[model samples]
Target chain A: MVKKILSVAICAIVLLFVYAPILLLVVYSFDSSKIINIHEFSFSFELYKQLFRDQKIMQILFNTVWLAFAAAGLSTILGTAGAIGIFYSRKRVAKPLNAVSQIPVINAEIVTAISLALLFSMVALYRTYFSLIVGHMVLCTPFVVLSVLPKLKQMDSNTYEAALDLGASPAQALFKVVIPQIFSGILAGFMLSVTLSLDDYIITAFTKPKTFDTISTYVYNAVKNGTNSSTPALRALSALIFVVMIVILLVINLRARKPANKGA
Target chain B: MQRFHFSRKQLCIPYGLFLALFVVIPMLLILFYAFTKETDGNLSFSFSNFIGFFTSRAKLSTLLMSITIAIISTALCLLIAYPIAYILARSSFRKKNVLLMIFILPMWINFVLRITALRELLDLIGLLESQNYLNTLIGMVYDFLPFMILPLYTTLEKIDKSYLEAAADLGGNKFTVFTKVTFPLSMPGVISGITMVFMPSMTNYVVSDTLSNFNITILGKLIDEYFTTYDNWHMGSMISIILLLIIFLTMLATGGFKDNEKEARGTNLW
Candidate 1:
């Protein structure tokens, strides 16, 4: 009983450490107190209003969502194809291919970003959305493949054989037998890709078009210049984001549970 | 083609082409530019760019400072993360998954947002009042902590529970069990997490640029300054090439990449 209590305490403490700053951000988003010291506080929607009212923030938001979706979709497709190709191949080839695919995941992002910048400049694709997309795609595809490959590993080879023996064509066998089994993995991979693309700042900073600005880059400039005094507005934006993350994580957990319960 | 079979040889083209274009070719270009110079008459390959970087006192100081910061931050992150990862892996608590979720959640948010949030938080605490290198180091650790924790958590989770139990049963105390059994067992995770955090922290430009206000000149910012402001492509590529070589040398010196390969193989088992 003591051990269990200690475990709970440990878990709770870590969770607090993780979420306290975020909670503080959320609470302070509504705090009437401009300064950090808040002996007395009043709830207000001023920050939220200002966040919406700011035209530049809105543009950055649009750019962020646009880049996230674009990078996520392209990388997901490429990574899905790569993972499936490796899954379908013999073991010896797949092993080396898997390792090679993972090099980007482990390489220093700065190095990768700089390398991409050089490559784009050489190819005369620098400062274009195409360069940004390709850079993000190269960075994110390996993660998607890594996430999805485990699901493929769990799949029985005989299932495809059975489908084939039942007169299913190769295409039918893949679309019908393999993909259905790996749908969850595909979804997880997509989420991972989107998150990585959305979170990416360094690469985007290097390769992004002059006119385009990601949310990260936008916020970065604000913090760098220190002219922006609208702290509450940024806090409000982070608060909303924190809520969105909670919702997404809850959904993932709920989905993860369903499978295990069904299996049991 | 005789037939469209998914053979090992066939798989080589896409992966090979992508790696060559993205990794190999650019690295070659950087190296070429690193050793080249603009002659009075025409461009020529020379060693002046490389020579200049090593000889420049300010640039050399910046590179050393960046290396020192990376080493410090990597050490601090590992120290803090190991204990937290230990609890997560060893504990039989309710809501373990939820706790793990919280630990990993920061990673999902935009890196820019997280760094910005920390900057605000530090400002609130008045840590940003003075341009403290310690504050900058803290920011690096905070930003890269998840990279350390996640790999460590995964590795620790895979450790056989029996090893710890056996250690305890053999009259080893908690610290002994941790050092002799747990630490050795989780070395692969430690290696990967360290490499994951260390490499980025070493090469990262934005964290220092934002948090430290360029008071600290890391290699990444040096590369950026040359490439962006000066339009000195030769110098920029030289710095980048030197950065990559240092990374390669560090990887060899620490045996970081070899352990990562082992970790990769072990992780691939399931």
Candidate 2:
């Protein structure tokens, strides 16, 4: 009993450590005063109102979401195809191919960003939308393959063969028989790609054009100058993200618990 | 000869092309740029960037500082995450995923926003400006805790209960069971967790950048300075290669990319 109690105490404290900053941000979002003085503690929607009223920040929001979806879509297709190919390949070939695909996942983001920048400047394509999207795609594709490969492993190895024996072409077998079984993995990979692309800063910063700005680059710039960063609007935005995360995680858990549902 | 053909090899075309063009060539480009330099109005491949980085006292010290910070933050994250993951995995409660979500919920927020909020929290406690290194450590631990916990929890949860039953059946005490069985079995998770947290903390300049008010210059920021402020790709690429070598050495020591461990990591991840 004492052991269990100790475990509970430790878990609670660590949770506090994780959530304290976010909770503080949520509170400050409602504060009327700036400059981190909460002694006055006048509660208002001042920061949230400011966040919505700012035209540039709102535009940054749209740009960030739009970029994430576009990048995620392309990477998902590339990654899904890659996973399927590797899953179907000969053992000797697949083993090395699988290992090679993972180099990006393990490399430092700075290294990846710099290498992409170097290669783009060779073709004079640096700081373009194409470079930005490709950079995000590079960051995300490996993980998508990783996610999808396990589901393929869990599936029966003969499903495709059976489909082909039924007079279906290879393309038909992939699109009709195999894809449905692994659709959940594809969806999961897409979600993961969206998150990674959204959270990315280093890659985006390196490859983005001068006129483009995401929330991360914007927030980093607004704060990196000094200790007196006046961008409290991020506080409200942070709280909003926290709420969305809870909803998504809960919905995922609930769906996972039910064996019947696939969320497609 | 005129007819089109399709084969399983065709599926390899897109990713194979992607790997060659995007990943392989770009990595080779970094190596080229790292070794090449402009001297007397000519671009020539030499070891000056390597020599220059090693000869400078400031650059070596920053590398040491970055390594020290990464080690400390990685160690702190492991210490805090292990028990929480252990509890969450071993809990009999049905709604433990909700509890897990509480620990993971903070990660979904933009990390820069979270760090900015951390600055406010540190300021409220009067530690932001006065103790720059401590705040940086605090911010890193906060930012990276989830990465550590998820792997540990997943590995711990996947351990067969029968192993514990067998250990107990053999008259092993709780202490013996943990040290002899539990900890040994969890090594894969621990190694992966360390790999995930250590390398990034070494170069994730934003953590220290947000936490310290220009009082610190870690290796990542040094690379950024070379690439941006000085327009010195040779120097920047050299530093990046050095960083890559450090990562490669550390992973070699920990068996991070071994085939067996790669299989262990690439499956069952949420």
Candidate 3:
């Protein structure tokens, strides 16, 4: 009984530590005062109103969403293909490829961002949507591959061979039998890719066009520039993002339970 | 023999090209920039950036300070995360996913927004400016604790209870069973968690820049300063190469690239 109580206490404390900052931000979103203060502010929806009224912010929101999906969609395809190739290939080729894929993950994001910037500049593709999307792809693809490789490993290795032997063409075997088996992993990887692309800032900042702005870059600039009109609006936007994210993820989680028929 | 089968080369071609284009080529660019110098309307390979880094006291000290800060933050994260993971793994909760979800919920928000919120909270407390190191450490620990906990929980949850039973059956006490059977078995997760937290804390300049109000200077922040602030590509590339070597050495030390089955399972992090 004491052990259970101790465990619960520890969990609660840790949760508080993690949640306090976000909760604080959520509260600041509602404050109408110009300066951010914990207390002594009237509760107003002014920031939310401003967030909606701003045309540039609104357009950037859409751009950011489209960019996220496009990048996630592209990376999912590339990363899934890469994972499949790595898992099925000979060791000599697979080992180096496998290790190489982890470079973006293991290396610092600043380094990755600058490297991409330099690469883009070399081809005069710097600060274009194409460069930005590729930057996100670099950020997210390795993770997709990492997530999918495990599912491929957990799969029955001979399923592809069996499908081929049973008169299914190679493409048919891969598309039909193998892909279905790893569908859960791919779905998870897709969700992760979306989240990663959405949450990314460094890579987004360095690779994006000078005129472009995502929620991350906008909020980063707003905060860094200090108390301004957009800063207050960004507080509202951040709070809304947190709430919407929770709602979407909760819905997905509840929905995802139905397809978790891995063993049962 | 079959009429036709998929060959390895065909499957590997596209991604191999992508990797070469982005990963291999960009890396080569960094190396090229790092080793060469632009002089009198011509570029020549030289060791100036590297020599400058070593010769400059400020640069070396910045690297050392960054390492120290990273170590402290990583240690704090591990200390706080382990017990939470252990409790979650050992509990007999029917809806455990909900609990795990609570821990990861912070990650859903834009990280910059989250740090901005932290800045406000610290501002209210009057600690943001006065306590630079402590506040930065707090932000690092907060941003990274979930990364540490998730892997630890995954590995701990996978531990066979029978091992503990066997140890207890051999007259081991609770602590003895943990130290002998449990801790040893969870080494893979511990290693994974360490690398995940350690590497990022070293280079996540965003946390320090936000939490410290652009006061604190870490190696990552230094690299950005060179490339963007000073527009010194040669120096920035040199610093990146050095940081990469440090990361490589750290991964080697932590067995992060090992293909052990247990390690792979532990490292299946999202």
Candidate 4:
């Protein structure tokens, strides 16, 4: 009984540690005050109004979406090809290559951002959206590969062999056999890449064009300026993102639970 | 008898070309610049950049601070994660799945968003104004808890409960079984989780930057300052090179590349 109580206490504390601050942010977003003090909270839509009307914020949002989508598409194509390639090769080479692909996922984003910034400056590719896209893709492809490789591993080797034996060309085998089987994995990987690229702040800040401003970067600048109160806008945006994400996850989970007959 | 597949050469073309151009070549360029000097009159190869890194006290201190923060955050993450992971692994609660999802859901959100949320929360509670290091440390611990929990949970969930049962049947107390059996068994997960937290924690400029403002200057922040605000590529490159070397050596020291091989073979764990 003591053990149970102790476990429950630990769990509760951890939850509070994680979420209480988030709740506070949500509360302060509704604060009518210029400063973010939760105790003096009063409802206000002024920040949201400002947020929607801000031309700079809108431009950054567009840039962010562009980078996220472009990187997601590129990583999915390259990552899927890399996974499929590694899946077919001998263990000696494949294992090392797989590890090489995963290093970016585990490496510090700051290290990577700095490296990319240096790379672009040295190569004279700085101050361009292409540099940002390339930087995001490098980090994102590994995650894509990580998500896709497992499904590839689960595939039976004989299916490919059987396709070949039945006189289906290699392209035909890949299109008809392998592609259909791994489509869900690839889709999941693509979504994961998009989310990661969208969320990335450190690398994007370093690698993006100086003129560009992502949502996170905008928030950082607003906080640092300390002249204007932007907390409400930031919080409202976060809340909207959180709600959308949760709904998407729930829908995906429910869809996953449906009968296998509906899977197709 | 099999029809032709895309040759390995053909398949590797685009990705190989892209990786070489963007990933490998750029790194090599950084390394080259790190070891060279741009002469006032004409650029040339030299050791001045590296020498400057060692000579700078503040830059060196930032490196040490980063290492210190990474170690502390990783240790805190492990301590907080292990018990929660244990409960999740051992408990038969009806809400276990929901609980697990809640634990991991934070990771899916934007990292900046989460950190910002923590910042606002701390500001409201007056924790951010703490005259000491409490706010930064606690903020980091909260942000990184999930990274530690997920890996530890994976490792703990795979542990055979029969070992615990067998230990109990053999007249061993729960503590004894845990110390003698469970703790050692979870070492792989522990190592992986520590590595996961450590590497990222070490290089993250944002967490320290936002949570502590400019008061806590770590290595990543140093790099950002030089590269952006100062426009000092030589100093930035030197710092980048040193940081990369430290990271590379750390990876080697941690047996990172080798451990993955053992993990893939499923033989790394004792």
Q: Chain A TM-scores, one per candidate?
A: 0.87, 0.92, 0.88, 0.86
Better of 1 and 3 by lDDT: 3
For candidate 4, the iRMS in Å is 6.0
Model 1 backbone overlap count:
0
- Tens-digit lDDT track of model 1 for B1-270: 686654323533564466567766766777776778777857797888878989999889988988898899999889878877878876677756556656766766766766766666777777776866977787788778777777787789889888888889999998898889889988878877767677677777778877776577788888888878888878888887777777777777666774353223122211
- The DockQ values of the predictions, listed in order, are 0.36, 0.53, 0.54, 0.42
- Between prediction 3 and prediction 4, which has the larger DockQ? 3
Name the candidate, 2 or 3, with the larger lDDT value. 2
Computed on alpha carbons, the lDDT of every model, listed in order, comes to 0.74, 0.83, 0.82, 0.72
Candidate 4 lDDT for residue B8: 35
Best by DockQ: 3
Q: iRMS for all predictions?
A: 5.0, 3.4, 3.5, 6.0
- Candidate 3 lDDT over A1-264, as tens digits, reads 999889999999988878787777678788867667655878889889988998988998998899999999999999899889888788998988988887887778989998988899999999998899999999888877877888888899788889989998888988999889988778767777888888898899889999999988887777678744435787777788888887787776555555343221
**Per-residue lDDT of model 3, residues B125-200, tens digit only:** 8998799889999999988887788778778989999999999999999999999999999988888888887877
Index of the highest-lDDT prediction: 2
- lDDT (C-alpha) at residue A95 in model 1: 81
Show model 3 residue runs off by greater than 4 Å: A154-169, A227-230, A258-264, B1-9, B258-270
Query: How well does candidate 1 reproduce the true complex, by DockQ?
Result: 0.36
Pull out the clashing pairs in model 2.
none
Instruction: List model 4 lDDT by residue over A103-159, tens digit each.
Output: 566556776777777777767898688898898899778766666676777778789
Could you give the CAPRI-style class of model 4? Answer: acceptable
TM-score-sorted candidate list, best first: 2, 3, 4, 1
- Supply the DockQ value of model 4: 0.42
Q: Which TM-score values does chain B get in all models?
A: 0.87, 0.92, 0.91, 0.88
Between candidates 2 and 4, the one scoring higher on TM-score is 2
